[model samples]
Structures are given as structure tokens and as C-alpha cells.
Target: MSDAILSPDQTARALPYSALAQEIATLLQDPTVAVPPRIVQALQGGGSLFVMPAADAQVAITKLISFIPGNAERGLPTIQGDIVVFDVQTGQRVALLDGPTVTARRTAAVSLLAAQQLAPRRDGPMLIVGAGVQGRSHLEAFHQGLGVQEVWVASRSRASADALVAHAHSMGLQARRVDEPNAALADCPLVVSTTPAQQVVLTARPRSDAFVAAVGAFTPRMVEWSAEVCQHLARTGTLVVDTRDADHEAGDLLQAGLDVSTLPSLADVVGQTVAWQNAHRPADGPVFFKSCGWGGWDLAAARCLERTRAQQG
Candidate 1:
């Protein structure tokens, strides 16, 4: 067997964001499907490297994502890498995807799917709490998936927030920059947090019926929501997680003094227990979705991209 390779340019021509989001949503509906597990290797410079390999019936894909916290000062991206798709049965290489773009699209799509399931069906203002790649991607996803009327960008750096607002407006979105996170929360019922802060930052909890998606913290030491917020989510709304074990190991719930046993898995939500649990229960607070960015989602998205390429060819 030989190694097969497809470059970033080829991936762009093959898989666009619109198609990727639809395929990802379809893949998430099936619980019988399998997702690849992630393997982490520690680097010498206090950074970590990840190799995620996954496949379904049609094709398999492997992604390599590297994280170096100190790269920002050097004008480099903190998260960088590439994705390779392959023929699952023959082990032939199919395509190579831009990791950052793929990650951004898939992450936002996952959140959008969760929102569709949990949030009320209405078009209104939305808030994004980070101004980096993930933050920008969330804006695109919300536009594509939810058709939001207005967008509010909020970041620690005022300039960054203003820049994102400018970008959004250029894309024909009604957007503005907000200096305070609470202001953003107050204005929008839907909020997405994409920061890498070590402690809670959002000043106030989201509205009682609001939906908040937190995808920034992948480690135990990093958290974007406060303990009070997590407690509110656990008590009132449906908290959906990608993996129960993973969330138990590294989520705001654990840090907020809540037992892992108390939370529900995304599987539960897909199975329709979340709604029942919510209806039969008391008012706890806001609904929350915490995603650590699963490799299975990458595999699913990569597989969809591969299929699109094949059909186009």
C-alpha cells in the first residue's frame, strides 16, 4: 500500500461550508455510527500534538492538530494542522483538508445542530464571545445555519471585537461590537463562547430560556464560564455534552463543584430524554452545550467532503 495525499486547495474546491454543515448534521443523527478516538502526544515545548483517526461506512480520515500556547506572540496561529481522508477498505488516500478551516466549520456546525434541537425557533440577535478563528467561524455558521438578524461581537480586546464586527458587516451582517460581555448576553438569546480564558469571563448568566454553547475549554485548567453559570445550567436547563467521560474529566461542571454523575450526555438529548427531563423538572437556569471538539465529528465532516469531491469529479 502507498500513501495518498490531497492538498488544501483541492479540499476547498471539494467541500464548502454549506455542504459540510448539512452532512455533519445528518451524521450526528445516527447513534450507531462510530467516531475515531484521539491520541495525544506531548511535545518538548509545553505544547501538545493530537492525531485523530476516524471512519464510517464510506471513508476514513485522520487529522493532526497541534497546539502551542506561545505561538501568538510570534504572529502564528495557536492551533494549526491538516486533515487526510482515505478509502477505509483499501487504505488509499483520498484528500487532505485545511485543518483550521475544517475545525472552524465543524465546531460551529455542531453547536448549530445543538441549538436547533434545544433553542427556540426564532430569528434574533446572537452573541459571540471570542474574536479569533473560532469566533469568526461561529459568525459564519450562525449566518448559514440560523439566519440571525443581528450579531454582537465581544472580546477582551476592544479592537478585536470591533474588527470582527467590521468583518461581519462587510459580509452583509448587521453587527456591532460590545465592550461588556453582559451587554452582549442581554442583547442576544443565543451566545457562543470561543475564548481560551482560564477563568470565568461572562459577567452575567444568559437569559433563563437562552442557549449557550461553550467550546473554548478543552482542558481542566481552562474554563470560560463561571461556577455560578455551570450550576445554573446543571440545575435548570438541559446540559448536552459530546462525551460523558470526557466532560467529567474536563468541563466547567467539575470545576463548578457539580458531580459528573449529575450531567446528561448528548446521546441523551438525541434520544429525547433531555426534553422530558426538562419538562418534568424544575427551573434551574440557562441551557448549556459544552463541546471539547471530538475527532468523530472531524471524521464525519471529512468523509462528507470526500464524497462531495468524488461526486464532482
Candidate 2:
């Protein structure tokens, strides 16, 4: 039987981010999962459409998301789409899932998972760059996953940033808006960048022992971390990627001219912890996880949401 279309609200309510994060970590370690590079089409006026697919022995999923930079001005989200899932054994359609919600929650949880592995501990204010959907979702993720006591929202738009802070306060978290991201970075032990800026937005060097997750600027044309920041990561920190294909999709890595082949994957960390650690760590520096996102995560999250909804009934 086909499931009803799941709205963003419903999806959010059903998503168990912490548990899902563990599942994602397990999936990452699983050699059987296959997630190819997303097929992107250049739309007119600098817009783009992405078709991402993932599958395994039990299930298959494909998500179609569109990016329209001007949507924010019109009071709309830039990332919008849906994920379609099918049963691998029967080849039957099973569900239609809210794409942005799934993408936002899973992306944040994945980042948090990586942070848990690398970060010494979560005990300070988190600096969230870009107060958009990803930013808000990540705030929730860090709050729930790490018990983050304080959060600082930094955005290009003062209004958006302030609004995010207000939302955080409503959730009983200590939150505020900061116009200067670099200054905010100085004090925060955990930092997440979720903007889609074409130019490097974060120029400040993070703390020596900080944990930074850069989740925006997926395309090679866009960048969140400055060249110097990337250089510092390459030199003094362990640079972890969601996938080695990030060598191609991650703008920060590509722009920095770093050798992706040499970078360690999250899978490596999951499977070979000691070796990965020995190879990637600098004597002293911030650990960085650059995620371009992948379809495998989409499929894993979809399964969890679908199961939760089924049990609810």
C-alpha cells in the first residue's frame, strides 16, 4: 500500500535524530551501501536541480531538490523537493517523503555524529553560521545530541539571524544573534557553517582544539571556508569527509586544491578508528568535517521516518 505524503511537520515529529545518527554511522561502515554522485543540471539564471539516488538490498530512494537563490527574498526556502522510496524486493513504491526536512535533520545529525567522534567534548556555546533551515536544524541537533548550553546564530541577514535566536529561546535554549561570525568563532568550541555563499564567508581561524562542521556550499563554485581556513585544516587538523567524492563536490576542498585521495572518510573513522586517527590528526588544531551530503543518508533517514510513522498507527 502507498503511504500518504508526509509533510515537513509530520516528518520532523517522527524523525529520531540521535538514533538515526547511529544508523547513519552504521550505514557508513557498511560496505554494501551504494550512493553515487548526485546528477546536477544547470538551470537558467544560475539555479540548479539535483537528482540523488541511493539503494541497497532492501530499499531504494531518490530525491529531487532545486536550488533557487532568490527564493529567500520571496520568503521561500532555497532548498525544496521530495524523496521517493521503493521496496527493493517488490519494486513497489512505498512512500513520498518531505525532502528539505529529511535533508536538514539528517545532515545535522550526521555532522553531530562526526563531531562526537572528533570533538573532545561539547561544553561551550556553539556558533551556528547561516540562520537558515540547516542552521536551525543543526542547533536542534547540537542541543539534543550534545546538550549544548548556549548557541550563537550568525547570518548575513540580521533579521534571519535574530529570528533564529528567538526560535532557539522559545525552545528553552540560551541563544542570541551575532553579526560577526569570526568573533563568535573565537569563543565557541563547536561551530557549524550552513550558508550557501559563493565566496568564502568564514575567514577566522577556529580554536586550536575546536570542532567545525561545514555543511553548506556543496558546489565547487561555492565556498564557506576561506582558503586559509582550509590550509589550516590540511596542515594542523584532521579533515574528514562524508565521502571521498567530496573531493569533487565539496567546494572548500576543491578550491583549496587539497588532495582528496589522501583525505580520510567517515567510513574510515568508523571502521579503522586508530589508523584514521593516527593518519589525520595534527599535534594541535581544530578538527574539521566537510560534508557535501549524500543519498545514502537520505535513504537511511527515510527508513527510520517511515518505520516510526508505521508504528504510530
Candidate 3:
């Protein structure tokens, strides 16, 4: 038995960010479901190929994303790909989602979900590092999910940062560009790093009651946050990750000399562990949400979109 197939255009018409966020939240609460695992292929030119397959209680989805670092020089997208959804019971093809847009939205939504579960309050300024697609997506997600009051956008390229701020302002957001990385970190209670830099970009440490979401640098060799940030997180006891697997990909933690076994997983937090509950507050020094990009999340988003589209018909 096979399922129906949906093209990227169909997914766009079906699944939007608002609905996707809600569905992701619902799926996180239920632990009985199994999300498909991801297979990564590393290339010689600092690029990676990722294949993620996931099945919900009813349907299944797979997303294939390729990140080629060199694409930026060519004025092309670094991350490009597509997603395929299927019916689990029938083994039928269901839909195809726009990989770039879906990836950007789903990744940010997942981070926002973590913040909702782990962060203390929603009304505050957010600092976003990196001015790429993920950075823009994070801004939109935080605005929609958290109803943030103010947002600070920063990147190594001043022009890129300025452009991001302009885009945010056009969207009716209170946004500003900052040349100083630490200044941006200091201004916001929540900080999201979306850059693909090889080293840590944030210079200053976060406040005790701050939340940090590091969504960049999926490869073991790449790093966005610093060792000091990880060390500070350890000292403050406010570090949380989307998955244990992320630590293996995050250079900051691996280079920080901290035991990977000590990091808490997002699943444990969603499952309501005592350690997570006790230490997962904004009052803590800095709560770090590190994401390695999960395919299950993409499937969840795709499934929600599919249901909505079906209902409309």
C-alpha cells in the first residue's frame, strides 16, 4: 500500500509556520512516538548531506538537506533540499515539502518550543547571531512564538546584519543591528546563534537568567558558541540541548572539555525529568538550547500541514 504525494507548492499552501509550531508542540508532549533517525554524509569541501526520515502515529516523512559551505561565495544558498511525506500504514507517498523553507521554519519552531518549555518568561528581548536564512527564521519564530518585545540582529558582516534588521522592521518588528557581539548578548534575555562560523562568535557571557539557543554548526568541525560559553553553562547549570547527538556535532561543547554524558537531552526535558524541571528556569545563568537539526521535527511539521490542507478540501 502507498500513500499520496504532495509537492512543495502543496506544502506551502497546506502548512504554514503558525500551524506548524502548534503541531510540533503537541508532538513533543507525547514520548511514545518514534521519530526517524538521520543519516549524514560529509563531503570534502566542508559540506554535508543529510537524510532524515520520520513517522508519526499515522504518517511518515523524510527530508533531504545538503549544506555546501562554498555556495555562499557563489551567492547561492548554503542549505538546499526537499522533503517527502508518506503514509505509515499504507506505505504510500503523501507530499513533497519545500526543503529550504520547511527546514528554516521547522528548525526555528523547534528552538522556540524548547524556549517555551525551558525559558521562564516570553516577554523580553532576543539576540540573534548570524544573518543567514536560519537567523531570519529565528527572528520570525521568536516573534510569533514568544511575542518578543525587542530583537537584536548581529553578524560578522555589518551589511548582512543591517539588511536583516531592515527586513525585521519591515515585518513590523522592533529590531536593531549591532556591531558588537557581546552588546547584543547583553541586551537580550534570550540569545539564538544561527551563524555557521568556525569559531565562537559571542564574546561576552550571558546573564544568569538568560536563555541561549545555538542552532548553527551541525558538523563536528564547525562551532558557533565558545568553550567559555559551555564552561559558563556548566558552572551555572543551565545548559539544555535538543538532543544528546547535538553535542557530538557542536564544537563548543566538544572543545570545552566537558563530558558529553553530563549534557541533558531535550527529550528528558519534554518527558519531565526532575533535573530538567529544577534547572530549566530563566533564573539560571544561561540555558543553552543546542539543535543539530532533527528530521522528526520536519516530519511533524509536514504532517500538520498535510492535515490542515486536507481539512480545507
Q: Name the top lDDT candidate.
A: 2
lDDT of 1 by residue, 239-307 (tens): 767665455455576788876555565556656675436542345456777888777778767767656
* Candidate 3 segments exceeding 4 Å error: 1-13, 274-283
Compare candidates 1 and 3 on TM-score and give the better one: 3
Query: What lDDT tens digits, residue by residue, belong to model 2 across residues 273-300?
Result: 6648567577777888889888988988
State the displacement of the C-alpha of residue 61, model 2, in Å, after optimal TM-score superposition: 0.5
Clashing pairs in 1: 235-284, 236-284, 236-285
Whose lDDT is higher: candidate 1's or candidate 3's? 3
RMSD of 3: 2.5
Quantify all predictions' global Cα lDDT against the true fold. Answer: 0.74, 0.85, 0.76
lDDT of 2 at 291: 91
Off by over 4 Å in 2: 273-278, 310-313
How close is every model to the real structure, measured as TM-score?
0.88, 0.95, 0.90
Residue 63 lDDT, candidate 3, scale 0-100: 80
